[model samples]
Structures are given as C-alpha cells and as structure tokens.
Target: MKNLIVASALSLALMGGPVHAQTSAPAPAAAGAKASSDPIVVMRNEQRAARNAFNEAARPIRAERAATVQAAVDKAVAEAKASGKDPVVAGRVARRQATEATKPDFDAKMKPIIEARNEAMAAAKARRDAAMAQR
Candidate 1:
C-alpha cells in the first residue's frame, strides 16, 4: 500500500512537472533589447506609434484644408471687388462670406479627421488598458 501511494504521488508530480517548470523559469531576454519589462513602457510605446500614425494621416488633410480656405477667401475678395464695392468693405464682407462658405465644408472635411483622431486616441487608451491589465 505504501509503495502504491508513493508511486501514485510520483505519477501526479510527474504529470504536473511541466506546469510548475513553466511557471518557475523566467522568459528568455531578447537579443540586444533593453526595453524595461514593465507593462507601462510597452503601452507607452504603442500609444506613441498610434500618435505618429495619426499625425501622418492628419498632415495632408490639414494642408488641403488650409489651401482650400485660403482660395475661398481670395475668391470672395475678388468677387466683392468685381461687384464695384469699396475694397475695405468688400474685404470685410469677403472675409465674412469666405468664413461662412468654408464653415460647413470645413466641418464636413474635419469630421472625418476628428473621428480618425478619436479612434487613434481610443486605440492608444485601449492598448494602455490592456497593458495595465497585464500588471
């Protein structure tokens, strides 16, 4: 009976050996990598990458929006003068008209950009959350 009990215990220990071994051993470090094993550092890196991508995506949209608004303002001023208005008054009117004309279009164009930025921010937050959960 003792022999049988010892054998059963040995078998159980052997069956659980891999599990214990896995938990006991530290994961091998990567070659030449100095990244802190901290979850926060990993999360920050991910967020930084997302921010970089968002900035890259936003740059062209910003440039185009600026050019379009400028062109619209210029057109408004030219049109005002062509109508025989005083240049100062025309310019004021043009500025208002240009602003009004561009407002909706600008909002429309910016909606997607804003949404994209929000998505990036959300993704960054999600990554951070996940990383925090790891701790």
Candidate 2:
C-alpha cells in the first residue's frame, strides 16, 4: 500500500512536468559549461538526494510509530463505543490523545533527520536563488 501510494505520487509528479519536456533533451548550458557542473545545480541535486535518503531511513520508524499510535486510537474508540458515546466524537478524542501520546517519541526519532534535511534545503534554496538572480 505504501509502495502503491509512493508510485502513484511519483507518477503524478512526473506527469505534472512541462509538456514539452518529453520531446527532446534539454538544451546545453552556454559557453560549453556543463549544467551539472554548476554549483547551484549540484547543491540542488544534493539537497534532493539527501532528502530522499532521509525519507528512506525514516520510513520504517515512521510506520512502526504510526501503527503504535493507531492501535491506541483504536483501543480508545472501542472503549468509548462500549460506553455508548458518539463514535465520531470518540474518534476525534482518540485521535488527539493518540497524537499527544506518540508525539514525544516521534519527535525524538525524527528531529535529527528533519533538521539535517531542512538545513540542506535552505542552503540549496539560497544558492539556487543567488544563481538565478545572476541570470
């Protein structure tokens, strides 16, 4: 299911690209300067690669944590239903409680990865913007 969702998302992203991008190779940079050699381009690519690596590393941890939280939510909802409370309100309360219960653990696991990714993205964005401004 995760694989299907990820594949669908990737395919949708690809489909959203410029329509003419499929027609031919992109034009080379001027003066024979390779586009890939540009520092800003390199930084952008590195940022994406780092983000992907973080996502890959975080996936299993996230899945396990989500399942644990979901179990708590299910248990809460079941208990509430057994007491004759409104299921919708019960679900909302369960969700909030589950989220709060799981948040500290989730944040502990994800904080470093999130911080590194954010730094990489910020650096890449700054470099890319500077490069664009020179054009």
Relative to the unseen true structure, what is the Cα RMSD of model 1? 21.0
The alpha-carbon RMSD values of the candidates against the true structure, listed in the order shown, are 21.0, 12.6
lDDT per residue as tens, model 2, 26-84: 55653344347676767767787779988987998889887987787788789888998
lDDT of 1 by residue, 4-37 (tens): 9999999999989999999888766643233765
Best by lDDT: 2
* Model 1: CA > 4 A from native: 1-37, 76-89
Candidate 1 overall lDDT versus native: 0.72
> Candidate 2, which segments miss by more than 4 Å at Cα?
1-35, 118-135
- For all predicted structures, in order, the TM-scores are 0.50, 0.60
Q: Pick the candidate with the highest TM-score.
A: 2
